[model samples]
Target: MEKTFTEEQRNFKELAIEFARRELNPGSRERERRGEFSEAGWQKCAAFGIPGITMPQEYGGLGLDTMTCIATMEGLGYACRDSGLIFSLNSHIWTCESPINKFGSESQKRKYLPGLISGSLKGGHAMTEPDAGSDAFSMRCRAEKKGSHYVLNGSKTFITNAPIADLLLVFAVTDKGKGFAGVSAFIVERGFPGFSTGSALEMMGLKTCPLGEVFLQDCEVPEENRLGQEGAGAAIFNSEMEWERSCLFAAHLGAMEKILESCIAYARERRQFGKAIGKNQSVSHKIADMKVRIELSRLMLHKVAGLKGAGKRAPLESAMAKLFISESYVQIATDALQIHGAYGYSAEYEFERNLRDAIAGKIYSGTSEIQRNIIATFLGL
Candidate 1:
């Protein structure tokens, strides 16, 4: 299906593309190598109102709908080489900010949304624990009511932006006997007593995106800090997941197109057996497949965005999009690597890095296996 974007949305995409080329493309490799999170780059994005695109204007945001946000993110991925940075930004927006915007009380929005939108305050979502990777709701973290506050005691690992986040939306058990419904969400700030970040994790890719553990020992959050009701964490988390699964990959579809272009360029220039690699059917076919995947993935993403913008539930669509695009990304990266042959295997080209980053897509934001399960359940399995 052909999708049409508004003039304002087109302008948003153009602005994001320009900003990405100027700010994110040049130093992406070096930043990844040094494991450096670019405060300067983030500030540039903030100045462009990237952090506020989907937020309300009253809260210092652009209040763009879902489609505009996806368009902007796609432009960023097309022009930017920093996948790690894009991933981190998506995590902050969908997982942290969107939840607050959707579920937080009016006072909570007033207290946190502005800084979050302006990039003055960074946010992270803490849900995964050491024992609860794919089965994320199987958490051991506990929060007990004490007076007017909830005393939290738990540890969450594999948390994105944990080391540098100013605010955290965390999930813990308020009633352990209630299984998944027992989980509750809280908004915790940095420097809260007994809240500390663990060591930074060394990841295969996305090095510039800091991942760490959050330890909450007797951390006190007032009743007002609670995101929703005591048993609303699962609902809130599922909503965020729908947003994250659908939108986080918008950038990736752009990257897939970029990779395709790069591979085609290499195939035409690099000669083998007295002819360019493009002359070979294998090389041409790989490029063809890449183009097909890019087009299909883009369509799926647009569908999800449209559904979300129309205030419709999109669990099946989100899962399908996430499953297909993530696996397609891995395949595209692999084909790009193969087209480059030995150069793709080396650090001299970005293909290797793209391959490494693609591996994580299949794992995080719900794994391919988990997505399949979700799809099956939707089919009434």
Candidate 2:
């Protein structure tokens, strides 16, 4: 499919590029060294209308169309080097903000959407447990409906914004025997009784985004806090995932473009033996591969975004985009590192961090293996 941006998209992309450069890139390397999440950078993004791009205007959002959002995100990735912060923002935008906007009752939206979109209330969904990685429906978190409230008991690990989150969208089993149908979703306050967050776990990369555990032991949530209806967690999760897979990796695509551009620039400048490195087939071929991956990744990402912009569900397309872009990102990152030679191996160089961040794309949202399974099942496997 041929993709062309309209005037609005072009404007949004320009705005995003400027915003990321001015607001998000400063102090990024230092923050990354300390593994710190930048609160100021997050608010800067909020002021730029990033966290709320897809939400309605009344809720402090830009209310941009999906492709425009994607385009702006690509711009953000291209200009910003803080991949972890971008990842955190993406998690909040898609997994938390979009679902609440789509499935939330008006009161829920009025209560939560504005704070979240404004970046005053950072949060993310809690679905993955120690045991429920790929088998999400096998969640052991139990919620017992007791009069006007539900009592929750379980622990969720590897949550993206757990330590800093003021709120959390939690999934639990409301009916033990119904399997997936038993699952239910709820919004829990950080201070709610029995709700606690663990220390941020250090990771191989994307350390600027806090990752930790959410523990809910005998936590009571008012019935009013439940998302959608009773036993609707599965549907809500799938709904979130479809949007997440389709759009969340947009920044990574932007990173790939940036990496490709940087490598090309380097190839033209660095002299190997006698001529520029771009002269060698070994060096030039990697750059060529990077170009192909970026082109294909952009096309696929755009296709899924266009589908979503039309209000159609795109699980299969989203899976393909997620699978392709993520794997391609790692490949491009690897190649970028190779092209940078020894410099890529040093912390002083951006390529080292780029490769580290790209490796994570394969694991989150759904692993590459899981994406293939979803694609296979969609193809009548």
Candidate 3:
């Protein structure tokens, strides 16, 4: 992996690690305990150029490649204890910013990208309805075209950043007869008439990220706000998912490395009986497994990044990477907790928090089961 990056990319990773330790690490524990969303932290990340890593320079971004984005995210994950902050940042980048950058009209790009990239405007997307999670194409939300505008109706649950988002790329059915092709996406502002957000929903992890519900009841959207052509929602969605599976999971690889290092340190310093616990085959082997997971996760994640950087579609590779990295993080977290014994289970240490966060990795950005199904379909099974 060392040879995989240019000197500039490696420098970006190192800079991100140092910046995260200095800026995002403070008060993270207290913020998580209170489920607080840190506007200050968000701005700090924006100021540090996180939100704009992969965006165009004209849009106030760094205009870097996908590998740099992944590397920077990995560095942030390794150094920053605020997993929820990083989670929210990933959601903002992959789902909202990347979509508009890819598919939005020039006017739309001129309108939204600057604020989004600068973190002056929080953004996300509304796609997963209460009934449409894994079967996301089966969404019931409808958008009826009326003259120069469209009126949107339906609700989205488990929407990341909904409670505090400035805008969302909302998906809704425009033609029931067309199945997945019937759907269209709209760049809906939070203040759009008849659009309201539910209070933030509490979760087992990523609490500070502010997950919630979005309700669009006859919500009026200008025709100009429509993203791409009508019925392009499915394509837009798949594109974003590929990006999410590739880039969002890079943070998990970083977190796994961090946890493995912690466990190794604990195993070496803490003694059992007459020797360090690391001397025991049982403890040492568990640590060894962690190292293997981190290496494998890095390889798979970098493969997806390399593919995307080359302007290639990687549905199969992204699925495999997401599934493997997410599951690996969960297993690694579990092992770290066990290795630390009571300290891992207790809140005094961050291991317990890491475990909670890792479990969510398996569920989001396409669940592990969903990824396996995608892979099987790709194999012609």
Model 3 over residues 184-269: C-alpha lDDT tens digits?
99999988999999999999988789999999999999999999999999999999999999899888887888898898889999
TM-score of 2: 0.98
- Using all chains and alpha carbons, the TM-scores for the candidates as numbered come to 0.97, 0.98, 0.99
lDDT of 2 by residue, 1-381 (tens): 114788888788778888888888989999999999999999988888888888899988888799888888888888888889999998888888888999999999999999999999998999999999998888889999899999999999999999999988999999889888899899999989999999999999998999999999999899999999988999999989888887778888888888988999999999978999999999999999988988988888888888888998889999999999999999988888888889988888888898888888899899999999999999899
Between candidates 1 and 2, the TM-score winner = 2
- List residue ranges in candidate 3 displaced over 4 A: none
- The numbered model that scores best in TM-score is 3
The number of clashing residue pairs in each candidate reads 0, 0, 0
- In order, what is each prediction's RMSD in angstroms? 1.4, 1.4, 0.9
Candidate 1 deviant stretches above 4 angstroms: 1-3
Model 2 misplaced regions, further than 4 Å: 1-3
Q: Compared with the true structure, what per-residue lDDT tens digits does model 1 show for residues 150-208? A: 99998999999999899899999999899989999999998888899987899999888
lDDT of each: 0.90, 0.90, 0.92
